[model samples]
Target: MTVSPRNLRALWPLAPCACTALLCLCPALRGRGAEDGAGCGPLLKGSALLLAAGAGPPTLLVRPRSDYVCCHLALAVRLVPALPLGDALYLVPARQALWALDASKPEQRLLAWLRQQAPPDSCHLKCLQILKGLRDLSGRGLEGPLGAQWGRVLSSYALKTALFSVLLRGPWQAWQEQFLVERLEELVLYLRDCLRKRVLMHFFLGNPHVPEAVPVPRFLREAAPLNLLAAFDAATLDAAATQLLAAWSQAPKIIRMYSGPRHLRRSPALCRHVPEASQEAQSD
Candidate 1:
């Protein structure tokens, strides 16, 4: 059967999910080190070592390596325990003046340590306040050693924003579909790249407390909030399915190495496109 370019283009949004399914369907074609039972023990061990080094006694006072490592650990921890609840909670503070603390001053170190001890749920708000304070202090030309500290705060906020976008929005869903499939295709590609980067970072540098092997099913379950499957109708889903199948045909072997073989098989029957199916069914 000949599939037209247009037909294939129409199926692109479902590429991520379809690729997932394909991995499940062809177990024998799996690459080396693709064994399903592989443990992430090695990866976790490395992360633990990094964490100990990063969190160990303050040896070099000049660079603030402890601060940087702690921040990354905090980000990693957030990914597993909490869902990005909403955009409002993730917003950066309007005032960036509260972060101005003298690095050399004992009081400043005390303040920073206190802020660090704040509960994770309250960290966002406390961090925002610190940033605003720093920005204001910087304005007055009194920031001194806290300059680098302010930069770290801002960088953390930026990372949080990017992570929030991924968690709250589906990787396959687009801000605009009417313009062309190109934009949506770009989104799929971008999400895939983002996922790859995150996985690699976690694999290489993540904390030891984190699990070594993140099973494909477990990852998908965590990613369910961002899958975009809940948002489509049968017609849209079908179009997505077609695009995904084509995309999978061209996916790199490494990308398909994570999951089991059964994931690739489509349902025995195709879905019907009823725009109101979810709403009507819910009301019934």
Candidate 2:
């Protein structure tokens, strides 16, 4: 349901869609309070509500033209109402001319990275699957330590960003079958660090490390760094860190539960190669 900014102009005549009223009812909107005036110019907070209210399926129209595309997107969490039993529309409003350019959207960036830089095998797919499996912990007792802020802080996209950051830094060769558990451990630790610092930076915005070949808008590169955790307060961050530390400690066992026998068998041997895992095991 993504459309060009011009398409949004068509809706300008429609009574502003009660974005404020709808947003007030959504707890998800409150987490992004810091994003106002921070680059994306405050998400069209409840625009997704408008789409959900329609008779058909839920449609979220994103205009990916500005620095906003580089930040976190937890659109699924924002849709309060259930829609018709059709596929959720996730359209990217790219013009035909811009198709050749690398997209700034996080999903597009991950896709491009997998095609161009990931190991030429199914290892990257396994890595993604492990991350996806970890997401099951979101609303469970473990994550409850973060209180009401769990949904905002540990969204699936946040985990993806952590993985994206790890891949960008390399040791790319370790993204193999043998290191699956260890890599999962690495990603968990990275997320713990982000929570500790209360700043999960948008991977593409103002990131000098992104490959030059990826066509980032000049404004995004020059814009102030976007902190996805900007709205987190001291208390929320403290609780988040505590919850993640517990997860980090249990990462291997938890991953073993979700992963296959191959990953399970490799865990001990793989821990030897990942320094942090080895140290944690010894301390345990």
Estimate TM-scores for all models. Answer: 0.16, 0.56
Candidate 1 structure, TM-score to reference: 0.16
RMSD each, Å: 26.3, 15.0
- Model 1 C-alpha RMSD to native: 26.3
Q: Distance (Å) between predicted and true CA of 151, model 1? A: 32
lDDT tens per residue, model 2, 136-234? 553466534465677667766677678778876777677766777777777767887888888898766577776776666564567567777886787
Alpha-carbon deviation at 220 in model 1, angstroms: 18
lDDT of 1 at 103: 12
lDDT of each: 0.29, 0.56
Q: Give me the runs in candidate 2 sitting further than 4 Å from their true place.
A: 1-106, 142-145, 248-258, 269-284
Each prediction's number of clashing residue pairs: 29, 1
Global Cα lDDT for candidate 1: 0.29
Candidate 1 at 194: error in angstroms?
Answer: 26
